[model samples]
Target chain A: MNELLERGPEIPAGTWDHDWISSVVAKAEEYSGRPSHWNGKLYEQPGDVAGVCLPDGSMTISRKHVLDQARPAYTPGETLTSDQQFAAAEATRMAVFQARHSMSEVGDDSLPGATPLESLEDIALENARCDQFSREYSGRIAESMTDQSLPLVAQAPLFPAYSAATDRLLYTLGGPTGLSHRRLGELIDSTERTQRLNAIADEALDHEVGELVPESHRAELREHLTGPLRRGLGGLTMTEMSELTHPGSKHSWGWDSAEWTEVEFSTNLGDIKAHYESWEAEHPGEEPPELPDSLRETFRDREEEIQQVWASKGWPAQQPVVGREQAYYERLPDHGPVTARDQEIAKLQQFLWSHTAPSQHTDSAVDTGGRPDNVRQIGSARKHGRGVE
Target chain B: MDAYREVQRLYAEAMMSAASGDELVAELGETVQRIGDLLPQTAPGERASVLLMNSSLAERLARLPKETR
Candidate 1:
């Protein structure tokens, strides 16, 4: 029995001993029914293949050939290549091998005692458990990585580019060498475990969490956690923009009053009004005119326009708009003639006159209302003259 | 294995089990919290040291207190 087991298989001794490359070529040739060449070298048997080759010199039988060949049986203690799947049967074999080894190493006197047969059975069961865990866990990781509703900012790391403004990390995984979803998931799982254990150590160390974790390890953890965390926080909805900008706040996006100042009439007018009233009270002597309802409505309507104007000019919130307003009026260049019943013109003239402090002129009240009848007759005569022409 | 290695092994295995980004993140969070729990309540600098040593773990830990409670 010992001889039978020991002589199970031979590599057919050759110049090369690396098993993997030999197997790859041997398997390729077996599938193709022709000699296989890798980077211009030939491998006739398992033991003749080199471990590594220059990139340009290696070429194998096409992938199609391998699928046609009979699949090899795998047993525990054997490391599979990266492409090999850990099927249930293989997992069972590995489990059994592990159990037997563990039991033998620990010895019969140890708490569990040696029972190779029973240990093998237990291994089978454990493999099943692990398979289920892997299936469920992989599914979950895939779901999180692919969920699109999680905003570009939050999803940036998981996707491709990392944007500070959006708090997103995104990058393309379509290129060569990018892991498939399953493999990438496995990698994520591996890193995640290290992260958790470190967390536990961090808690234990408390004040010494940073000291406990090496700087390099910390950087790795940061790379892994940053994306998921940014995504998670990106899910939060702020009822108030102020909540975003508060000191030490974790939320990256916030409302700037200037951005919404035009629309403040609708959403934040009450707060603004209260603030204005408070300011007015504090400055007691200055009486500002009450904002008329029409003017307020006009201001509200102009919100979009104001935002566009402000954005175009790159004006700060505190910059006066009076110049812009005057420029706008100047562009129009036409205001109807000033005639009788011009209360506005009269008011303006009276204000101007008061400012001049006329020394000799008697302070006489000007009755501008009487000129409206004469102005109406003149307009009628002009229309009659145009009709005659 | 050393405690750090052991803990890291378990953490990596747990992470592999994570099914989604949320789950992965949650698992990361739990791991950080575990570290936090195990951490000694020494000086702030000491606490920071524990976190800084495992910066990834520390970052996850930092995010948790603000988010979970």
Candidate 2:
């Protein structure tokens, strides 16, 4: 069974105002034990349903008296005794009464001192206006509905800002080939990290970008991206960035489609880190390894820009390695002849580095803006190989 | 309910006709579809008022057994 079906469908909490609908659905689900369906069309939303299917595959409407004339109808599926039907009906009736009573108490009185008939007319007028509004803003309404369940990081008015901030940081540090893990550690101290984030947030607020990242949502977007969502970004790499930007590519990571929780992403990166650490111990060398045949094939498959990225990043011009298990090459680096272990290590460190704020304890020589002799061993991308500036 | 279905069919036909590049026809179709969507909320009878008054009741009744109603 679909997990959403198991619990019954719901308008995600904090996003919708239709609690009455949720309660009614819950009550119906209680007696039915599962959602109503017709020929496999799941009746997830009450508004979409016309009637319920009986065990014998027939349909039925609701009773009068139980549901007074003013109230809408429900169509519970299969084997609902009159009593169960009554119970469901009674629940709906009570829910309606409560919702109406609450609204009368708190709802805006657009026409003060208006008689009951006038109020009804006003409601009809409002309904028409709302229908017109829906027609005008149908696309936005649909986008909003689709986006409601998504995390703030993944949703609009935030995703673009998040993407822009990340790209800016990466570009500021280095070009296509980002800073090596060791160099990244030295450049961004805790204070600088804090300042950079604050600046990004401020920039987002100051700039009046229309729908790309709305001004109204920018403040909240900044708070979230700089807060919980910030750490999740640590796991991103050049390959991941490529995937994020080219959402339609075959290599596309389907993070947007699914509920990608921060814990799951961090745990995934942690597992990769642990595996790469073990591999690093076994294969301990800085020089780019012999080119893997799969990497060469992947190079061919990529566009001209990616090919240039590979060529400039010190990949061997010829003599590619072959006959290895394809699975072994699955984690191979996008550029350079570096072993999968090296790329994995860099990816893991990148995630960790992004997650952490500047360290309080720093190497005096490294922090003094002076490069240590050992730092030369693990050099920056530009220093390691001749590449396009 | 039968009227609602008829309206829906008419609305769908209007939409299909409008797709053939007539602006006035397209507008007419859009109006028809909007009326069809709002039928359950605005029909003259009490049953039509169900979703507009209490959406939950509409949802529940839509899924419940006929129970000889």
Candidate 3:
């Protein structure tokens, strides 16, 4: 048994099956020992085997040789458990359910039949792979000497840009060099954990009551749960998110604290603090939730729960058949005009930005001294100004 | 009354205002109740909400007082 496995996999306790954890770590260590190489760098498994760089600066490889490469067996951890697999599949199915709407939202309905699912699955894979590595190497990786800035904001095209967003969100590669950027990896890991916690928190709320959201409203309800409802829950740490739903949660996605400690924060700690402060400002009399202090912790004082409550709660019974034409409850991430707040927010920002004319030339240097006694006052005109589109 | 918009705004405010421990539970319950009552009286699409709503409705209704109580 590897030394790490003896501690029984350094992962969130209930997020994955024990055997599955064992297999993933064991396999990861095995792959770490593999000798698959192209030139100086190691291949990211067989699928990454592009042709070697030639002297003429061209690259070439036979599709046959690439496929013929003997890659080791690797099962996706996202689909490792049948239930998670089902949920992921259902998530994609739902995305496809609204594929037309998604295409329309993207302003082109001419996508190939399978593009939506394929793109979503790509996103799913990226998320799962990031989740797996983060879980596998949590806290073990080192800090990156490289820049940790978040990727510039992009609209994330319905299906096409899902990947770019996922890539932007991840820091380390899944290769041996992956665990090198400990801080970045930890941040990505925390993010992945945040999503899981969001899902769990969402499950708790959706299942908390006998929700009679009408079928016509089911999609809207689903969108609500995944969106604002998600933002509502996003404030809490992984532990807090879980414990709210599972009061004595024993699960661990690394960081879990109840006070404001600098070390226990995401790479974007300043932003999170600003967000929390803004949230406080936005909700004037409401008490803020308990939150963790650290973004990175080398040690944990895990609460011991002798009894396993893994079976205590589950997600709302999701059905892919709820959608019109049996579409899923919500469109995939890249789908059509989001009837939700996300789309509204985007449009609102665009309107605000377009209307403000921040870049419009102002004769501040010209002074208001003798300026426009009658020389076209900037105020009323700009105020009523039909925007310069 | 654009109940959905109202609910979205209020619900967001409520969540932003929530002081831990599912503080919005009561608000959600009332919102659900009001929407259920009002939507049916509002228009045809609203009427569809009354008929087509699913277990999430039941779940929200069930959850309102159960855990918080």
Candidate 4:
């Protein structure tokens, strides 16, 4: 059973002891012989629920309404009413035994906005919490109907793991075998990740160069590169910007056409900035490290000149993700196994994806200082997978 | 304090993701397939791993509002 969904959102863990349990157990004896209002069963068997403790020290088991909605139609191999449903299905039931233990703290109704202890004792208590749970359960059902509980890849994008990789790559970029300092070109993808990135990178670069933002306005771009985003994105250059902003590009891919969902198009600069701000809030105090002169040039004087040259040049939109993945894997025999050097980066990628942040080129938004447009939906060519950078 | 929690965490870890790096990677692949089968079902909005993976992401999620965030 997925405890997360079963419990609604996660509640922070807390302290509870046997002595406390014993006191509750004693109070709960009152319900041993009684039948719950909903179920005909006696309340002798109390469930092992982590009760929400009130300030007065009495513990309360958070109640969830037992509804068919909370049960997903397909749970690996069964339905709701089956004897085989997860034991956590007990979660929907009013665990009356535990309620009795929690009922004692409310001697008088002085706690403002708090429910009375007597009401807490009753298995049939109804109020806002219960109503909220009902709504949440319905939303859960609707969500399941839409987002199949998982993605094919559980891995994260490049990160602190990729940080070491990015740094080494940066060191070598002046030489060969690295992503060209020039905006290397084209975008193609039947999948969301690759297409989104290429579109973001190319679009943002073009958008920045086209619109003439004055020098002072470009300071943020320099700083943005060195921020927490730099952990995966590396230094601030048009090349680094495009590559780092390629959020989903680091992921593995599936080649056959039928399996992919083509996501096409782009939005303006303001929307892109909003996306960056949201992700930035996700990482506090993680400003990027000081830029070496090479990388910092994007942040320095003549920002206009740099943006202009890249904007004027051509950039590849992107290509197939599978071929890319295969290329990276092919290098494994010669370059060693496929492990990321910095685990923090792997963790960061997973964090971004799980949060459903825009997986494409918004990392470029900070470059132009928040002025842009959506990706152009062109014919999908499809490309990207390991070792392309 | 750290040692106690570490012991508790490791015990749970042993039962959770596989102990060996290769085993864990293999498990991730299998998990991905299983999740893929769930196609169209939204996993929880937040990955529980964020909470487990050092508190940085978790703290961020906590600080943000459910909607505006």
Q: How many pairs collide in each candidate, listed in order?
A: 64, 15, 36, 51
Q: Write the per-residue lDDT of candidate 2 for residues A1-389, one digit (tens) a residue.
A: 11111212433334222333344334433322334222222222222222232233222222222223212223323455444433433333333222221111112223322212212112222222222222223233223323221111221210221233232343332311145422332222111222333333343333322233334434533443232123223222222222112313201221321112232222322332333344456765432233234433322223222322332432211101111111222233456567654554444333323322122123333324332222222123323422111
lDDT digits (tens) for residues A1-389 of candidate 4: 21211223322234222222332233333323221122111111111222332232433333222122223422345434433232222222122223332332223334322222212111111111122222223223223332323221222211221222222322332122123422211111111221222222334434533233333433433233212122122111111112222323321111111011111011123333444444456754444232234333322222223222322322111111111111211122223343342232233323223222222333442224232212211222322211111
Model 4 per-residue lDDT at A202 = 35
Task: For candidate 3, give the lDDT of residue A170.
Answer: 33
For B1-69, candidate 3 gives per-residue lDDT tens digits of 354334223322332222323444555444445544444344332222121121122222232334552
What tens-digit string does per-residue lDDT give for candidate 3 at A112-135? Answer: 221121122222322333333333
Q: Say which candidate scores most in lDDT.
A: 2
Interface root mean square deviation per prediction: 25.3, 20.5, 21.3, 17.5
Window of ten residues with lowest summed lDDT in model 1 chain A: A154-163
Docking class of 2: incorrect
User: Which stretch of 10 consecutive residues in model 4 chain A shows the poorest summed lDDT?
Assistant: A255-264
Order candidates by DockQ, high to low.
4, 2, 1, 3
Which consecutive 10 residues in model 2 chain A have the weakest lDDT in total? A316-325
Q: Tell me each candidate's TM-score.
A: 0.14, 0.17, 0.20, 0.19
| Residue B1 lDDT in candidate 3 | 38
Docking class of 4: incorrect
Query: Candidate 4's interface RMSD, please?
Result: 17.5
The 10 consecutive residues of candidate 3 chain A with the worst lDDT sum are A302-311
**Chain A TM-score per candidate?**
0.15, 0.17, 0.20, 0.17
